[model samples]
Target: MALSFLSHCLIGLCALSLFAWAEKECRYLPGDSGWPSIDDWSGLNDTVQGRLIATIPQASVCNSLPYGNYNSTACAELRASWTEAETYVTRPAEMMNPYYQNQSCDPFVTEKPCELGNYAVYSVNVTGQEDVLAAIRFAKEKNVRLVIKSTGHDYNGKSTGKGALSLWMHSLKTLQIIQAYESDTYSGPAVKIGPGIIAGEAYEALANVGYRIVGGECASVALAGGYTSGGGHSMLNTAYGMAADGALEWEIVTAQGEYLVATPQENADLYWALSGGGGGTYGVVLSMTTKIHPDGFISSGALQFTLAGAPNESSFWEAVRLFFEQMPSLVSDRNSLQLEIENNTFDVFGITLPDQNISAVQPLVAPYLEELTRLNISYTFTTNFSATYLDYFASIMGPLPYGPYPPTEIWNNRLVPRSVVLNSTANNLLIDAFKLAVADGTFLVGCNGINVADNEQRKHPDNAVFPAWRDAIASCSLTAFWDFDAALEVNLAVKETLVSVYTPAIEAATPGSGVYLNEIDPWYEGDWKQEMYGVNYHRLLDIKHKYDPDSLFYGHFAVGSDEFTVDGSGRLCKI
Candidate 1:
């Protein structure tokens, strides 16, 4: 009897030990005993039909010693193309922000050793749902960190992860136009875009069918991924609606590795969360079908002025004040304006007015133009009319330089409520905040009066897009940049200035407002859950727990991300 009891105690102790070992907080990392073996990865590659690729730092071709693929000619070509947005989008594991890349492999730094610092160690070139499923399952079973990437145009470093297995959705280029998509709530032309389809490709494809869709102004942004998932805004937002407002259905693979179609009538909660809650959080999006509009002419106007052209500093500010004052009226006319303010320079890249003639903008900008003339400020203004929205977009806002120019750039933005623009006191305060931001860094402001609240009926009433956006008249972004070789402290100071000084100033101007999730400061100091998702955050959290209870899908500042933290070694661990 004594021997039997001792044996039972030993067995129980062993069972407890195994249980404790299985519940380790951190995910398996390379060189860890629990990490997937060669045979395991080989099986996954076979499952994905040999699409698995060992990650090579994009700049590896520029380095000589570490990666060994270096060639002087290829390095030169890479250095030239590094500034182009297309260069990063085509390469798996290449992100727009080099800051997240940890300056591991810089094309310009040939002497430095190229390493896969924060980039994924391996990636599955996802071709379809099967590939996504295989990768998700493998990561779940192996307890490895997994991340998803599409076009790699993320501003907040959500697409790239350190020591992670990546699902590179860039290859899933499937595009189909629905001539007449009919549903209980929506009846219109729609487009089914694969997760990989970028804005430029979608625009061209839709234009060929004499239609257009509301997508990101930056042509390289993937239409189906983070762009739409984080409440995509476009030049056509005032006339139509935000990208989330057009989402009719989403075909996604949840964290449970179950394939599901989420629409208003079925899996409605999933649909709402996936619409604007955030991307790379709730599930892996396979494709999205969004409403498309008929092709229509767009009138574009451009304006430019510098301090040298102004009578005085005071006069220049007055002109800027007048421009902000006129925003409401212009937005009421269904116009969208993209403004860039740096030091003493103010450039209106374009004021896009859909379905209007070039003459339509004359009255809209008369007040600001008159103010410029009254101040004796010399300015240049031009207007052009395009045959279609696609024509105007392609001409003005096609692929531009992304990053690694200044090397690192961070952004913090606010959705300026319409009420603030209408109130004189608030408007001046808002402009003061803008001036302060410009005094510190750069501000790329998008002015529009989109009625997302009214337009919600076009798709569904409830979605996860921040409620503040529904009442916003403009989106103001504060940007800061640093050199590639800048020290960590310098980068932190730049981000801290935006967080402490600029963000608070803007937030004070637009009280109770929120920021665009897709283009937010990664280290936002405010209540990020509220700022990004607003009143819908709790509901979104519930949905997140329902779908991804294990917290398998984690991105920086993404929903449910608060539950986990990435340690110094970059292993994601439950807090």
Candidate 2:
């Protein structure tokens, strides 16, 4: 009886120890105590299949000892190439967040020395679910903040955290095509992609098998990560739907270290939450299964007219105004339209009539052509009908935006409903706002909506993609940029200009509508709960608490993010 009592007492003590460990907040860096020792981290690295890498700032590649295998000449080339998209995307620590690098060091400034700031001290170069699970378990048990990253393509600063452990999911590149995916909710063709698989790669692979999937416009974007979870928009969206709408299932590692498959019938709540709840807030997803469509032809093209040569600047604005009025009909006809205006240049490009040929597309575009001629604006309009989606992407879509340089920029978005676009006064207000943004050198872009019609044939779970998207006919965004050498105050002024110029205009134009959460202004000050998620914020919050009660995962502007604030020093502090 005495021996048995002693054993029970030891078990109780171990449980108490675990509880206490979970309760205490772990501090590192500036903190004098509570940081994990080298041995503790080494043990964790071992458990994760030896994938942990202490983050080294990319800027250090040139200045570090022995040049890390590069000579002075090679270092110079690397320094110049550091500004390219691949340079940052390939590294675990380097990313799009200017604040992560403290906005002090950049490859643009040849004279200034670079140093790391606010970047995670260590990153797990995750290749599988085991690494993610172990990292989640360690972060929760030690009460250390955790950041999840895949390809470092996140526009918002969600993938970076100060003095934290990061799970770099970029190395987890795996893809498989299921000729026939059978499920109670969905029974069709599907593609299972690891967290690291990019949108372009997925498109190429799917096209090879006579299938195509809805994914992001950017080729470099990670489809299985934030893109799908945040309601991915695509050129194919007009004919199909948002990327999240095609999602059939996800395999994720929860905060409790449980690796579970979430589907419509199993872990239904998690499935719903993750579908479009905004990534980095739910569990770390290992793989995502997305519905694929049969490969088909897409009638796509671009038309550009110089605003400078127009009779007056108002003439260009008039063209844009007329375009907005026709958006609903164009969207209904399965046309994905895009408008980009900067300075004296105006460009319109997109795929129209996904199932129709170029001959059928000519009549649809004839109206816009007539309008341009009547306005005395000579425009260059070129249309091509590709045999497959891959041809369309490679020839038309991929080359549209050009290279991925100019890594830093200020951007914001608004979803304009069809009703508002049809309203004359509201439409003019949006036009005036666009003009103002252009005057401030902000690049303007707009896309016609994809979820114009619901397909009753395809069954899926409900997600948190702003319900405004359902009624909206178009999504518009404004972007302002500066070179790496631009002053901090200049960037701040650009953000303020965007806020002062576009925010109220969008509000006046579409009173009840909201912005796309994924592309929303990082500095957006409105009621995010209502704007980003519409009526779904409350349910998403509940799901967040259910899975991450301690708030281990946090994406910027995500549900339950109000509990924490990023301080001036770039530290994420509990409210």
| Per-model TM-score versus the true fold | 0.92, 0.90
Error of 2 at 475 (Å): 1.3
In the range 1-575, model 2's lDDT, one tens digit per residue, is 99999999999999989755543533344352556778878989899878889877766544533224324675677667655556766788777755345554455443555545667778999988778888887876665679988867655778877777889988878999998999987778999999888777788888888998887766777899898998888777767778888888999988878888988889999989888889888889999998998998988767888877689887988987887777676666556876677767778766456767788766777788899899998789888888887778777556422234345556788888878778888888877777766774555555544544464643334776678877788777776655456776776777776777567766766789998888766678788889889889999999999988877887788999988877665556666
Please provide, for model 1 over 402-507, each residue's C-alpha lDDT reduced to its tens digit, 9 standing for 90 to 100: 2122324577788988888788899889988888878733444444435454643233356788888878888877776645556657777777888898889989
Give the top-scoring candidate (lDDT): 1
lDDT for model 2 comes to 0.75
- TM-score for candidate 1, please give it: 0.92
Per-residue error at 491 for model 1, in Å? 3.7
